[model samples]
Target: MLLHTFLAPLALASVAGPAQQDHYGWIHLFDGKTLEGWTEKGGPYDGDADWSVENGVILGREAEGARGGLLYTEQLFGDFEFECDVKINAPFDSGIFVRMLPQKRGAQFTLDDRPGGELFGIYSNGYLFHQSGGDAAWRSGEWCHTRVRCVGHPMHLMGWIDGKLVVDYQVPEGMDEAFTPEGRIGIQVHGGMNDPEDAAVRFKNLRARRLPPMAGENFTVDESGMMTLTAVGEASGWQPLFNGVNLDGWVPNGGSGPMTAEAFEAAGYRARNGVIEALHSGTAGEIRTARTNYRNFQLRMDFQLTKLANSGVYLRSVDDGTNPSFNGTEVQILDDFNWEAASGSKLAPYQFTGGLYGAVAPSKSALRPIGEWNTYLITCVGSRMNCALNGTLLWDVDTATLEPKGGPPFAERAKAGFIGMQRHGSAAESESEVGASFRNLFIRELPEMGPSAR
Candidate 1:
């Protein structure tokens, strides 16, 4: 069972106006009376469409025989939050496009006939993500509200329908370089054959707010502009935490036998070439740095999960515990899609990859597809922590706000402890048998912040 909840309308946070003013410095994108600061493109006959402002709404009703294209914002933006209300009749297709380039390179937040709030990455030929399915939030008689947040640096994108948080996505590595971080915002009139005069889409209440840029190489700032944590870079005096060829400075735990390198290796934890890999051995385990106990530090590593595989990186923990996750902290690493579909399995939002297991949920899903390597940068200082998956800020949160499941209270978590990785087993509950691998493990210790810093 996947705990994916959509909030009720009354329970949703404010989407616009002074209620949102202090939280987000919003700027109106649509003046309502005219399509100023916007340009039209693409249609049956090259940028030709029956697009006009009518009754305070931007309407795109195709002319006879005209296929639709886009009405785009002239100004370009990078990291920002956007909101709008849309009304579309049945048998029509439209979308909200961001970072749009000339050849359809960018991302789209869908307004299709299917689930109305899904994200798709567009390229010259097709889309990058093919996921689809969700509740039909649209009605024949009423307008639908949608909200989107696309943040750069650690590029994370999110979407909400009727104020219900739905799509939380992370742009893949290398994929970011394909389109400009700053590009036009577009209202798409999907190109296809349809009854030109009858097919219509209207948009209103368009507004957006810009987010602060990612400031430091070692640290990250949240959307509201708060310093979360830091990842020490090469120039910042960071050192290798894993030496690649051997477990020279580490200890393995969670097994029932001798805790030696050989025992761990036999238990499926192995060092091959320059990578630390956990082959499938049907046993759950972990490995921790032997002599290092870190408080405020940045830990970076590259991880690859086999199809449906599961594992994790532990922070500030002891090796003697049976459940180190509850004892310390575990940044979950697992195949979210497969893990959720496993038989007899139940997963909460806080149990997915990049999540602070059983505590805080990741604001977005940022993992690469299983079988591909993804980079992770985790920084913990005082009560603040941040995780960046593949150069995207997955989430930034203050630990004091998290509610724990079955451990020492979240507020009372350890100040300093060893860094480690969990070696998951094929438990009877899930009966999963996928493998996990890691490499390029590095860490940089920072001076613990005092009371004033907290």
Candidate 2:
């Protein structure tokens, strides 16, 4: 069974005044006067529901003898914060759906504002959570401010009615495989014989803001605009690889394998105060994971570099003393702004930060400043490799189809091997120091499935 909590309302103000205006980074789903950016479609019923904009509010009613349907946003959202004011007539049934597609079952925040209805309850296949005493939280035939926040692959959902916390639910582990990570937001007018012709639900001041992947209760944005996870949520399936104090599961490349924190430090890396610092000692080497056979996984980490630094993260690399950049794959990491000036040579398109080194370049540059921390979210499954840097997707491509400029095709590279981080030797005297610092290293192994499976 899933767990949920109904907490006392916070002393937050009602959704009025400044709340009606658009904020930075927020997308207004409704234009207040027109039905633009939205589409009416049958959600679970056979015919469309009557939908229109009336006096800056979206009104939903049953169409003639037809059943009710959904009004969905044109754009899709994966993780987001959504807000709107809702007014429902008595005995009407409606809901706000997230990750919803037309005619498909989805997670819903119930607004069944009638006797025996479960207001603010979560309904998917059935009531995932049933909120009792719903009438205490509902204001019949009047506008009630509602907000929903959802995040993660198997989403954690929360809802508030009139500034009071009504539901906080995490999708159960067993249901992880069934959840859709992204879909359109929908407003449903449920079909039922009891729904009178005058019964309707109205929504106004609709807006939403997209959130980063895996962002939830444990995620935060620092003052410098860097996203950090204080701890991985249990439902997120992410395991911390770096314990913030040791290298117990890591090894120096070309050595006898995994070592203790002290032993690993002696091999040119320092682990202290939650950061793993690679000490560049004029000779290029790497630190690799002791477990050498990760075939499909999602790897996330935060890295900071000294000025003009050059480094790379190796995926599925062989242990035959061959260059991992050629044997497997490397996601290039460099001081993008200063690398060319310091090296006195131009960089290939595939040699910049977030690129699949030697094969495919990033779609755009998303690196933070050299001294500030930047994040990498790398997903590898079958022939596809996708990378996101600092919350921006850089590339999502199939390695099998890529032809490298000089080396063998990426399709021939090892499919299972060690995960490593490269230290690209020393920098010139005229250049700034060259080293990389890393933290929050986490990985979650994904089920072995091809791109079509996704």
Candidate 3:
């Protein structure tokens, strides 16, 4: 379902203070006195009716089942910063339109009733951008403080509850074109409404600030004005984790039978759609990291699973020049919720989502709702492995033992080598599907382990 389709009025947009202290901050889209540089564009409003303005808010009283009206600023822009304070009753949703080409490019930053409501997807053009944040604290009849920035190619959106950046996303490039040639800023009354239960959106304190285009150089910066100059050059070479189109750098190992890279990649092990995906049915080989090893590092990826699929990540591996799971230890990834993934596997609490694949179970179940992207970050050092799933630490283990009797073993935990991906057999489960989807795969190798922090 489209994000705007759901309505959960957030508490309130921030009153925190100007996002940019200087005069180059936000240019108010709503001038309390009148509709000024704004107008509606949707159902029944017929570009005729006047949207009410009281106490500074531009109220959008929704029409039953209507897509709602679009409020566009009289001005057009390119690279800029947009921020606003919005509030509405329950079931009401709205979005800040930016760089819209109207009939072509759609809203880049969409805010709705759901918590952490900042969505990055084109109108019907679909999504190629994402980074979302917000809490489910949105109830009816409240206001929300939201802010968005599109400078260079990275779109940073912050959804503030009352007065803080509750959700922040630094959108990567490649998903551009949502904003058009200095287009108008308009408000929409999203199509599909019926009765008072549909939704109503009211916005206030709107502003947009134009900024300069960003180059690769703009990527380096913290909260400090302490600017450091440097030259723009190709970054030093590093082993590619994924080809972004195919799994040309990995080999899966483990469980029952033989699984080859050719076999795995042939079954659609791909690096497409901005993510690396592998669909396995009855494979038994581990996918080993192509080059290099790591003593400690933060490895992160997003995935969606099918019931009964079993897999894991092997770290500090010793490549036999072919399969690696036979050498390194493994970190488990399975849809414990699926009876199939859990078949033969004990149905326990921590064992479900982020467990250490049979050795040490998680302290908590951190899996996301099905179909939602769940993130896992693993840090290994010595005999210690700390894992966090979706911002929550689920497993913290020390002095672990690995056994191939069931899966892979780690005799060299304190040592370092390659990383591996696990492939479980299909017949092992009821439905017997041995696969899932993985995307946004990235890793930042940590410094060599020093004295045990444990």
Number of clashes recorded per candidate: 1, 0, 42
- Per-residue lDDT tens digits for candidate 2, residues 1-454, read 0011113221222222221223133566777888777877534432477888888899998877746888887767777778899999878989899987654556999988776888989988888998875568789899999999888767789999898888999988778667677778889788754577688999998987665444545456432223455565535566777777778788877776566666765566777767778775533378888889988988888787776567889999977888888888899987788656545567888888988988889899978554556678898998888999867789888889998875578878899988888877553321333378787687878877633212
Using lDDT as the measure, which candidate wins?
A: 2
- Report the lDDT tens digits of candidate 1 across residue range 204-283: 99886555333245434444333333555456756777776677777666433336667667766777656777765634
Models sorted by TM-score, best on top:
2, 1, 3
Model 2 residue runs over 4 Å out of place are 1-23, 42-46, 102-104, 221-358, 361-386, 389-454
What TM-score does model 2 achieve against the real structure?
Answer: 0.53
**RMSD from true fold, candidate 1:** 17.2
lDDT of 1 at 24: 24
Better of 2 and 3 by TM-score: 2
Candidate 3 structure quality by residue, lDDT tens digits, 1-454:
0001112212222222222222222455565657766645421222322267777677775554354567776565555556666776655455566555545463445555544443333232444444443444344466666665554433444444555545455545654554333455566555454426535677777776544222124222222111122233113111235555556566543322344546666543545454555555433345556554676665655565655555667777675553343355566676666543233334544346676654666777766433334566676766667877765677666635434333345553327777766555443332323266665455555555622212
